[model samples]
Target: MKNTILLLTLLFSVNAFADHSTSKFVWSGKCLNSNCTRSEIEAENKANYQKHLQHIQDLDAEQEEEDREWSRQHDEDQARADALPKYQYKPIPETDNCVTRFYEKASSIIGDNAKEYIDVEEIKSGKCIFGFKLMAEEMCEYFDSFSSMATPDWSEAEWCRYRSELREVYIQYSGLVGTSAFTDAVQAERKAKLKPVEDKHHKIYQNLYEQHLKQLKQ
Candidate 1:
């Protein structure tokens, strides 16, 4: 009877222990359960919210950095563009037969003395002796007129021809005047006056040549 009573007591004790173990919750290390206190869960949730806010802040910072980098690059590019040489080229002027006008004026200035200075056979043979001036007075007058006139908006070819004629006239004039102190002084003064105008024309020609080359390449 005592053995049966002890057995009953043991069975009852086992059932009570099982019930107590199951009734009270225990942490499983996975998710929050009834075992978790409100304070613990709230703290965990606050930590997660902070992590989320931090992640968003990090993304915003990264985007801002990228935008700043892009802006910096754009500014650098613009600076380089501004630093490059910029040419303001004038529009090419129409052909006005300036070469013919230049020759006609020289011819008119030489009029009666044309036979003395010009070789008619040279003209017939297509040789360019039209620029020669045998008289100092005629040469002076022609040069003065040529220099005082404003630079024509002529084509490259016209400028080249005009310069050639001026050179021819100066050569003949120098030979006719010979090398006296007065003539030397006069020549020097004329050369000095002509230099700047010649330089401008030469620069224009260079620009035109470069522009044509670029067009050909295209």
Candidate 2:
């Protein structure tokens, strides 16, 4: 009877061991260590939670720094753009000047008269003036007539420009076919025609140039 009781006691003890070993402990709502007690599992979970919270805080700090750097760069770019210079255009303004008066007088003297200056070759080849000496004489007369149209009221600049254009034509036909007499006669006529008013108007325009510059500044 004592031997049977001992056998029953041994079987009961083994069954209790099996039940204790098989029982599970859950951590963070999931099954965890089989060997760990409840207190040890809770301590491990608290440490894990703290580490996860620290990682999240570190990520947030990094993101905040990046945002601050981006904002600083954007503000610098805007300030640079604002610092650049700006420009605008304006039209030329008209003035009541002596130059205007000269133009007005010149327009009346130079109308739709297209054939103002005579062509030397046209006169020579067309049997109008046959020989070289006769053609040269006719050319000189034509130059004189063209020059007489300019009045004493014209500016020095206008006169100089006209004289330069006429001198270029004289150069083209200087001396090949007995044209020296013609060019010399043309020069003498031009000097006589211009000398009287040129002395007066030349200084006037020079002074006017300075006056116009002052007006522009104002």
- The prediction achieving the highest TM-score against the true structure is 2
Residue 182 in candidate 2 has what lDDT? 57
What is the model-wide C-alpha lDDT for candidate 2? 0.47
lDDT of 1 by residue, 76-117 (tens): 999999999998899986444544444455567757444343
C-alpha lDDT (0 to 100) for residue 27 of candidate 1:
27
The regions of model 2 sitting more than 4 angstroms off are 1-34, 87-218
Per-model C-alpha lDDT, please? Answer: 0.52, 0.47
Per-prediction TM-score to the true structure, in the order listed: 0.28, 0.29
RMSD, every candidate, angstroms: 24.4, 23.0
Q: What is the lDDT of candidate 1?
A: 0.52
TM-score of 2: 0.29
Q: Give the count of colliding residue pairs in each prediction.
A: 0, 0
Worst 10 residues of 2 by lDDT: 123-132
